[model samples]
Target: MPIKTTKKVTNKKVVKEETKPAVEAKKEEVKTAEVKKATKPAVEIKKEEVKPAETKKAPAKKATTKKAAKPAVEAKKEEVKPAEVKKAPAKKATTKKAAKPAVEAKKEEVKPAEKKKATAKKTTKKATTKTTTTKKVTTKKMTKEEQYAKLSLDTCLDLAKAMSMNVTRDSIIQQLILNPDVKSVSKDLVNKYQLTGKFNFEEDGYDEGLVEVLVSKVYETADIKPQKAEDLQADVDHALNYKFTDVVADGEEYKAQFDTMRKVLMIAQHKDIHDSKNLDEEIGIDVEKFVEEFMDLAYSVLKTWKYEDVDYYEHFIYAVLSQLEDLHDTYRNRIMMDVADLYILHGDYGLGDADYGYILRENQIKDYIYYRYASIYEGVDKDKAKQIANQALQFVDDRFTYYPNIIAVLEG
Candidate 1:
């Protein structure tokens, strides 16, 4: 029994030892719980501090997002603006390039037009210079004496002016009385003055109105050498013998008839001058075919009549002029000069109702007409002579070969 009890005590000791170890394990767990409670407060404090910073950062993040969005919108607008600007500059550059070629083309076109204008101006200047030079040459050609040998009333008037003499009616009468034939007297005068060929004295002894009388007077006064006489005579004879084939105011047929009548009248006048008896019956002029020729012959003869023969020929002159009044006469102006001489010099102004002043006023007076008018007015009316001369200035042509004669009468 004692042994059994001791064994039980030892068993209890074993149980106690095990139980004490369990109690110690429970104490350690409680201590761990307390330590966790203390750490919880610290952890809560840290979380509280971190929460405030996180709250502030949330608003900052929102503001940063809004700023980013605004910048993106502005960048989009900037991209669009840059695209438009680049396109506009490109279009402008293209237009400038196109316009440069057009401007260059216009400049090229203007260059040719400017050259043409310059050439035209040069041509006009040359033309004017050439015209002036031609005129100067013509004037210089006229002064030579050899050029004077081509004498004609209408062709070489300049030469006539140089050779013409201003003689009186008394001088002509005296010259005629000295020799019955004025041609023979002219021949003597031409020989005496050593001017046989220069003075054209017709061998036929035909009197050509005032021309014959004037030639004789000029022969006496001219200081020409005998050697030049033949040239002057040939020129004058050629001019007189030149046929009137050119159409005048009348047609060629009328001119032919006029030439024939002039020849007949010239023959009749020659016969009357040499022989006192009228040759109208002998020349068959009073016949029906020659009646018109007869009247023309009588009229031409009256023009060359002496001052003493005016009374004898007054009736005949009236009859011839009255017959001419109805016809469309080419010699109407020439006939008027004879009428004027009769009225002014003689006592016959019997031209019925014809205006002498109106005839004179007609501007149809040419260079040849001026010569006849001036000769009529020379001794009788000096004022009329001067007035008629001054009026003829514009009628003078520069191109005429006989321009000098007309100038001499007007400007003398």
Candidate 2:
């Protein structure tokens, strides 16, 4: 019985050993399954943390997109401002173009008014020029009296037709008689009327009106007694019949004395006194005596006529001196020098005196008179002498050849 129990114990031990290994393997498997469950929970925690980080990243991306969109909007607004600026310039350009046409139209409207003003001014200027031209033309014409005044004394005498049978009641003759330049014409007419009785109304059938006018003019110009027109014919007849005795009581005697004086002058002319050095010895006639007598005769004639018959005295002196014109210059000059010397010595006579008019009518006598006066004034007033000497040279005649010598003496 003991042997059989040993065998059973051995079998039981073997089976226990096998069953212990199996239980260990089963324990390890259970440990592994629990660890796996714990690891799965950790992995799940990490996944949650990762998911939070992804959400923060997503919000950062959205903020960046919004910032980018704001910049785009600002860029679009800036572009719109530039477009509006370009439209403003275009509007200004259109306005300026429209204003230019308006200004041009205003200029066109003013042009015609300016042209009308210019035309009116031109027409007024032309009208003023025409008026001035007409005034100038009117002022150019002279009158008849002015024309006659310009004529010479000889021309006036010729126009009068004096001392001719064709002489009529001419207004020109009356004008000439009244003209102071031809005052001697009155004396000539009177002498002719007295000599030829040409003015006798009934005898010569002369115009009574003309005779009366002639008588009136002669007496009036001589400053003599003015006779009536009715008595002119009787006075003229009486003058003719009595040899001008009605005018002067000693008319014939005065005439004879003039004739004698003329003969003496003729004798002096024939002697050629210019060539004679000793005038007193060569020509028996005394020049000083002759000049004195001639002056005395002139004074006597003037005194007899109450100094009112200047024309008669002038005529007588002219008649006497006219004969000496043909004489040599030397003799004539010597005679005139003597006369000037005598005049200066007298001291009462001036060159302006009417009595000296006939003497001065001869150019040589005038020059000598000036020379004498200048020479006399040279000692007292040198300036006055030079002035007088210079005046002598102003005469336009051939007799003033010695004037330069006188001037040289004055200058010296």
Candidate 3:
């Protein structure tokens, strides 16, 4: 019995020991469960904090993007403003180019106007030149014979005077003969030498003989036969022997008759005295007798003559004076004094008649007379010569151009 008891007790001890170990293990497990619950709550709180921080960071990033977009927009507006300014300058350049074309067009218009004016001037010059050339051509087309034929006897005389040629009857006849028309020549001859009475062919005077000779020569030159020649001869003879009656004494017809006689005498005497080799033989009279007779005849004619043509009488006196100078005879001073007296008387008459040319001719003659007197008295009477020379100086001027000897004496 005792041995059974000891084995059961040992089994009970072993069981108790095993049960204690199991209880301690259960206590430790419960403590570990409680710590795990506390740790789970702390992890949940940390997750909530992380979620709020992430929301704030998202708002900051969106603000930065908005600022960047504002700067880009301002830069784009600045670029657009520069482009607009450049376009305005380009528009101004275009307007300037257009104005240049307008100026050039105006200049072209002015050039055309100037061209028209120049053309007008040129046309006027050409017209004037053409007119002058036509006039010259017409004048050149006329012949000398045609020109002379167109002239009248008066015009011919004027031409002779203008040409400084001698206006003599022979020169006039020569000029008249140049006319081709025979009727004109016949008419001229008839007008110049027509007679009104019978002429004495056997007249004793040299002038009558010379007139007869001149008529004969004219008839011979004309060679007009029968009727015309007879008429001309009869007319000339009548004119030569025309009688001066009291009824026609103051008439133009009587004056013409006296003029014809004087002309015949002067022409014949001058020709015979200047051209004849033997003046006495040609005139059938001594030189002294001829001069005396001519002077008497001229003085008689001058006393009766009351015409404007005093130059005709002057010619007659000058012819006789020239002959006297050639003779150098004792009658020279007397004849010169007579001529001077005649000139003085005529000069006084010319003052009343208002003939300036006659007064000038008288002054010339007086100067000549004084010079001649001075020369003649120079060797004979010194005081008288000096007095005459000083008197001549009063008339000395450009009109004394033909009297160089007179000027020399006056100066000396």
Candidate 4:
């Protein structure tokens, strides 16, 4: 009975030992509950924080699944659509069917173009093979004026200007031909411009219409010479002024204007005296009497005739005066002296001023006029002649100062 009781006790102790740990666990749970009760607000706050974390992870997991599915869905859909198939392929097909005629028309159009391309390629191949036909060479011939009209004067002159040869119009024309700008045409135009008898070398000699076109580009675009600038400028001026117009006008105003200038110029000059008139006789030379008589005719013309009606008064005036001053004959002197006397008598010193303008135009004229005047007065007024001859020196060009005529006049 005692051993059974002891065995029962041992079994109870083993069972009790396990039960005691369980009891301690129950006690820990009770204490943990009390502790949790004391920290319940903190536990609730941490649970709230963990809830947002869990919520964020929930959406992330859901989003990852949807992202994977979306790609799979889009890829599967794309596999059926192709690039342009989803775009109204029926309308596109109809448009393509409608464009068939245009395509056929384009193909028809391209046929001739392809033929031309093939022909051009064949020509190119032929050209490369060192076989030039005579027909190709002969097709490009041109006339002289036609060829000349094509080239700028600079292009024509480039060859001559390169060689530093004479660059005259004639010289340029001659050289440009040798460059063989299409051979014969260049040669003929050059010969025509340079070798013609009818072509004038002076300003008025140029074609008035041609002058208008060439003058603006004389130096820059054309091959004209520096010495020819003045000549060309004069031509353009003449073309712009008197020469372009017809000389016919009311009452022969043109002729009258030109004639009157010459008449007045002749009337203004001092007369040359003869040997008999030089001596102290009744017929003795009196330049004052000569001046008085000539001034009468000059005044008559100034009152009766016109001087300003001419188109080229400037040109005419100078030319007239130049002619009168060149007069060395006694008859010319007598006629001109009578005209001079008339001008002073009429109180129209305008003609004298015009004469002075002509003298002042060129140094040559100024010197010549003075020399002529002093020659007439040499015996009558030696002191005055010496003064007049000295005055002539001032009018002579610097280069011509030591000229033989100047030295002889100085000594005389």
Top model by TM-score, which number? 3
Looking at model 1, residue 93 earns an lDDT score of 29
TM-score-best of 1 and 4 = 1
Residue range 1-412, candidate 3, lDDT tens digits: 8954553443232222121222342454435333222222333323323453353343222112223322212222222233333333322332232222222322333344455567667978999999999999988666544544455555544543443334444533332233323445444443445421223323421211232233333434542222222223333345444444544443444445443333333434435444322543443334444445445444445534554334444544454445445544444545445444444345443332233234344553565556655664455556655765776667765576436666666556
- Ten-residue region with minimum lDDT total, candidate 3: 70-79
lDDT of 1 at 352: 15
Which prediction has the highest lDDT against the true structure? 2
TM-scores of the models, in the given order? 0.24, 0.22, 0.26, 0.18
**How well does candidate 4 match the true structure in TM-score terms?**
0.18
Score each candidate by Cα lDDT: 0.40, 0.42, 0.41, 0.36
Q: Model 2, stretches more than 4 Å misplaced?
A: 1-209, 212-311, 323-370, 375-386, 389-412
Q: Which 10-residue span in candidate 4 carries the lowest summed lDDT?
A: 71-80
Writing each residue's lDDT as its tens digit, candidate 2 over 207-285 gives: 3234334433433444322223243334323323333334364555455554444444434344534322333354443
Clashing pairs in 2: none
**RMSD to native for every prediction?**
40.9, 45.3, 44.6, 32.3
Counting clashing residue pairs in each candidate, in order, gives: 5, 0, 4, 12
Cand. 1 TM to true fold: 0.24
Candidate 1 — which pairs collide?
157-402, 158-402, 197-229, 197-230, 198-229
Output the worst ten-in-a-row residue range by lDDT, candidate 1.
Answer: 70-79
| lDDT of model number 1 | 0.40
